[model samples]
Target: MSVHSWPTQSLRIRTMFASKAAEPALWRLLSIVTLLIIALWWLSAPRDLFSAPLSVTEIAREAILLSGVWAYVLLTLAIVVVMRWRWIERPLGGLDRCYRLHKWAGIATGAVVLLHCVLEWLPGGLARARSQPSADASRQLGLDWNAATQEMAELANGTMLCALIAIALLRSIPYRWFRKTHRLSALLYLATTWHALLLLPPQLRFTPLGALIGLSALFGCAAAVVSVTGGVGRRRRVRGTITGLEAHNGILEVECTLAARGLPHRPGQFAYVCFDPAEGPHPFTIAGADPGARKIRFVIKALGDYTGQLANRLAEGQQVTIEGPYGGFDFRGTAREQVWVAGGIGLTPFLARLEYLRWLGRRSPSVTFFYCTRNAATDPYVSRLRTLCTQTGVTLALVDSARQRPLDFDAIAAGLRDPSGAELWFCGPARFGATLQRAWRTTGLPGRRFHREWFEMR
Candidate 1:
């Protein structure tokens, strides 16, 4: 796919697979169910001061005994927990995934806040709190304003949720707008946290003592917002400059190094790099990094539009922006044998991975590199890769499509020590990787042993 459509389309498929949208739907359905439950509670609970009708006091009576409100809270917690796994702990290597998941969790949490307000305001609920002896400490301290405080709380919370939804949906909105408005959400969450605590009696502050049930939800939100916004996520940028450029056939490759401390990345992770503000901070994996020497390297091939002009117009040190080191397409988590497949510049991160292995002194694992190109003439890194593989005990397969020759995988495996148990890692066009995966499955190996990273998404 073209770069312009890459992130959006890639994310759509991933989001679908993750079923993050399910959380919002779950919350919405629960909201309707919660309303029904509250209605039931109102019908059953004592209504009068004598009969509280649906006023704040009667609603408070049911709110205290509301069954399964905690279930919706549990649902929200599940989303946050799932997201924390995929984004924070897993080696996803990119922020797009995190951002998407973060949005999902935010919406779910916001929905729960909404339900909390509505459930409590039904007749006997807030009315009871309002009716509590006016001479109580809260009233003595000017806390007699339950009506105004509840509405203020709702306004703050609802507006923050709307801003988050806007940021998540209409991503064409400026990043600065997203950043500023979304920041308000954490502060609003803090406010809502205090609002909940202040309104509830000490005895009802939690479903169970010290669990701080409702309080914990708001805290989780505040923490996530701080983590992402305060540079704990991939919020920092490292500078880089183009040092060399060359065009071979229709392929354009540019060589560059990190101009500063460089970014921390694994062998196969990519960065969302932007040379201009108008375009995307497109993903391009780290093809090479001199970890001990302190510089980042990447090789980009011309795919059209802006890339065609890369060789001629990109000056050395033109100052590029980056949001980085994302994607789980690395072998750090695995120990199996590896088969790395590449199409054109998809070979970028693999080369760096090999270099990293060499520097770290681990005997590089047995590897098979599959290089595909129209011909040897158009392959940008084939010579360098072949030389590196030969030096590092890696088997290299160069597939030239024009020759119309069948690649004898059985024959290729004969040269390898063993093919089974060896992991296959593929990066390149989606179709190319998928095709290779099918072929690998025929080898009678566990499917998980074969891995593919869709570098084309960059």
Candidate 2:
């Protein structure tokens, strides 16, 4: 209910449209999917699909086959992405990016599945209009092997798949509702897997393309089982109790004492914290931690509907489930100097890094932190950040929007003694990060040197 908390649903919509630097992981995933599609299309599609003239019936048959291939590939990949396996997550640039990829894959699957269904209908509609004897599209297209039964089964499964996907992608839907309904997708995947196994052309059934699909289905089904059984991230989860909770400005600083074992987390990683089982877990950055001590802290801004209620629902001594120690935003680089830019709640990770550096007693790579906030006097973290910077020998700049112009490339570049040599680490609103990233790219800094968190995962 706090005015400062960003609405979660609106933020999710903004994240979908907000521009940022292209993720290498996303490009790599798309490339893999494209290559697989081409391989499958070449192996299974009629050799004369593009070479020779084709009739409407033949075209419809080919379109249906091609669209089915795309749906299978994307939907399978989407299932695998949600397994939350660390090895897979690390290659995909963290679990957040994996979820982003999952969302896109689901959208693409819905589209291709829709196309497949339409193609299935086209030939039947055309034949009926022309007064042909065949009422079944599969029979007219020479795809009939118990055609009526197959078509009904496909229609039932495809309709369910599309409905589930629509529920997932619509930002207007509540996340709790989405979470509950989205699990049905695994069951839907199993249904589609069965449909594919039964309907695939006999000629291509034993080919390499079929092998690829078979493997995708196997992995997807396994991931689906892991998800349905609530085993995803089970290995990483640990039980903990809330030891302290304090409200600063509109943010909550939650402290926890791990009851099981120490969660060895890097400076800038985050965790999926489940305060209430009914609400599920939400990701929060590890604001501070000591590897040896069974203690951790999270600075949370009530930016969404679920998060807004956390302050009231949580209390000291409350049992909670903590899964992770995920993310790759740790401020490690080879630059002689580091420029850190944090906007509002984005300061959490930087605060963690500063605390870590203070513990290490080393400030070899000089750092200047630009902390962006609305008001210096009202923002509680400003004083704590100043003290940490002093302890760690980091220079701190408070970029108060109320008193000064917005922080821009010029202001950041002016602070750096060598813009080209210094690596920039940023976390903030997606649009702000995109703006800064676009400006930074012009400086000829290698893209890898500019690090930021892709924190949105709706």
Candidate 3:
């Protein structure tokens, strides 16, 4: 539709979706962290870092401090993101992307911790064997604290943190175990926070770097507490009952009617649906819902262990906890033409948008929706999508991968009247979107012109 008004509580949908790229917020956050690290290094870095003939022990010590500080900051940041705070999630574009940020931050923290551990002991071991001064000599420069005892404790903590991160990164691990083990990071983070504060140089405790550390620890601890106490996303959660359940091919269509006024959500947004408490909440896009309506729909594909069993486990009238209405994939753009690509179950967001358009009786300038599926005959959505496209005045391009060639960037480009002037919105497999986005940008489309939602939670 031509910039139709959508209801939202905190931010105007029109304004929120006007932005072309979701990654600016992510990049800006990273830049801020980098600058903070640089500023802190300048404030309290060792003289040996700049002096000539820097010893291996000196370099190792410096690496230890730098990596530790980075790990601390990133660990805190990961906790803050996992809190599912709407304000933090909004700028990042969606909760799914926020989880993506969390995933990367955790991995980075793990890598930094590993680096810190290697630098902590490797140089000392070599120094001892070579008859050189022990690495402990560098500790005397500053950051005065218990040396041997704290070092042992830190190594233990670092090892454990690394282990947890490993378990998290391993997708083969059952999601239930992953969920439970992931909570343990909150405790580990608390330990790291304590270690950071306790060992910070006495003179620099009140400096800007210290303040950043302190504020981060404070916020991080708060978020960690929420996570530990099982209070994450509690305020945003609303009760709902399953009103309908259907299966089409391998997809599970879950329809729910809220017990209260529905949580405010924009079209193309998603929520964390808790169908089974034991398994916890998993994110599912709100495939169809009116703003503030009690009724909503989620189209889930059987892609994993937990979701594969949902069709059998879920039933009508069963209560559920929905913690979301998160994401900024609102179908808004500033181009002469808007192109949509949905791969299989990735059609959820676009389906929501089409329904919204039909309900509003609005039509945009020029819109093309490409629904890519294996077979159109067995795909239940094709018939309804065809009707919605007709009602909304949007062109539908069905790409049956089984019958014909796959939908590629060139195919999409061929349909566009002005490739440079059109915006592309894609929600599909990560590899598919990556290939399309690479080609789109290679052809001179601005990076901001392509809006895509990341589907990976881990």
Candidate 4:
């Protein structure tokens, strides 16, 4: 029987098995959060639950309240993670994974909060509507100041819910507008925290659950303050000047020399570069790093509004701020051979790795680099890449999709000295990576050996 035709094994099961090995870091994060949620729910459970029977509404209301608290905790944790703290990034696998978790937590928080709001209104909506005083009677009686304040707070909470849902669901919104609107969440979070503190049952306030909520709220507020003050990347940020700028086709190569201490970075890590204050910071992979010279290079494609305008607006000696040296795409582990697949701008990280290998001045592992480009003849970096590959003893395989077929696993694996033992490192479009990954599975390659850098932040 063929290896792909395992008896009684369904494709779904096979896919799950493969994913389990490939995404251990993500699984670890999910496991930790799941356990925490379960523990919190258990702790928050009422002691007299079985002693006295409660109505379905009572039970559901309690569940919704607990879920809301859990969601808030997760949201606070997500906020803390996004602060780009080095200590947190290391354990969480990388900054990319950290951001992935942040996005998931934000989405989960919005969903749970929405559910909580719906449940709160379900039991009382009709009764409240019928009992509300008439407009004339309300005017005659005058508004109750305390009730008015509570109503206003509720309105604010609802507004925040709508914003969170929109932020999570809408992807077409411009990043600048998205970022500016996202900052308002912190203020809304503060308001929600205040509301919870004032309204939660007094008996529950002294419990461990209450303490946890209080701490989370305090931490979230602190993070919000840091965010508002433009201190998100303050610790890691360094002033630099554009030492060189090179334009190739639609791509731009930028070199910066640091005014402060240089960031110690691994070969395949990335950094957030801020060239213009109005443009805001954008993440770019570090294509080269020279600690001695305090210089770093970035290869950026004209893919968006900020990057598109860079070639025209940027000039030598322009002051810039760089914050990071993030990501964990480094090739530190041992493998019999390495197969690197880079698609277009994804070649940035591999360029840095090749440079590092060249500096080593020793024959490294058997490396086959597949650079998939539109047209090899017109590729500006073709000669430069070939020179670097020669220096590092790497075999460069240029796949020109315009002339030939797209890259497939069979072609990539054919160059590998030991297909099973080789580690496959890919940096490219998500769909391209997914396709390659599926192909790898058909060949029964261990998913753990396939490493990919997820490039999309949104």
Question: lDDT: which candidate is best?
Answer: 2
Indicate the worst ten consecutive residues by lDDT in candidate 4. 126-135
TM-score-based ranking: 2, 3, 4, 1
**Better candidate number, 1 or 4, judged by TM-score:** 4
Model 4, stretches more than 4 Å misplaced?
1-28, 31-35, 124-157, 438-448
Using TM-score as the measure, name the better of candidate 2 and candidate 4.
Answer: 2
Q: Is candidate 1 or candidate 2 better by TM-score?
A: 2
Question: What digit string (tens of lDDT, one per residue) describes model 3 on residues 1-458?
Answer: 12332232113223222222344556577668867886887776545558687677666655666677788898888779868787788777777778767866776677777776666667345322221222343356664345543665576566666665555434556777778887877877777777787666565566667787899999999998998999987888999999999997889999999997777778888888998888888889989974465788899999977899999999899999998777778877788899999998899999999999999999754999999998888889999999999999999999998899999998899999988789999998766776787788778889878888876666
What's the CA error at residue 442 for candidate 2, in Å? 4.2
Candidate RMSDs in Å, in order, are 8.7, 4.5, 9.1, 8.2
TM-score, cand. 1: 0.57
What local lDDT does model 1 show for residue 53? 46
- In candidate 4, the residue pairs with backbone N, CA or C atoms under 3 Å apart (3 or more residues apart, or in different chains) clash, namely none
Model 1, span 1-458: residue lDDT tens? 45786687566456433443322333454466456545544454333534434754544644443522333343334334323333453643334344444555556555665566566555533534432532264666665555566676778767865775565555445554554565555566555555545554444443342243454566456465654455333445676776655567755555566666768787888776777665535567777766555566666776655665656767776777666677777775464566666776677778887777666655554677777767776565667877777667777778887785744445445555656657766666644454555556677766656555644221
Whole-model Cα lDDT of every candidate shown, in order: 0.57, 0.78, 0.77, 0.77
lDDT winner between candidates 2 and 3: 2
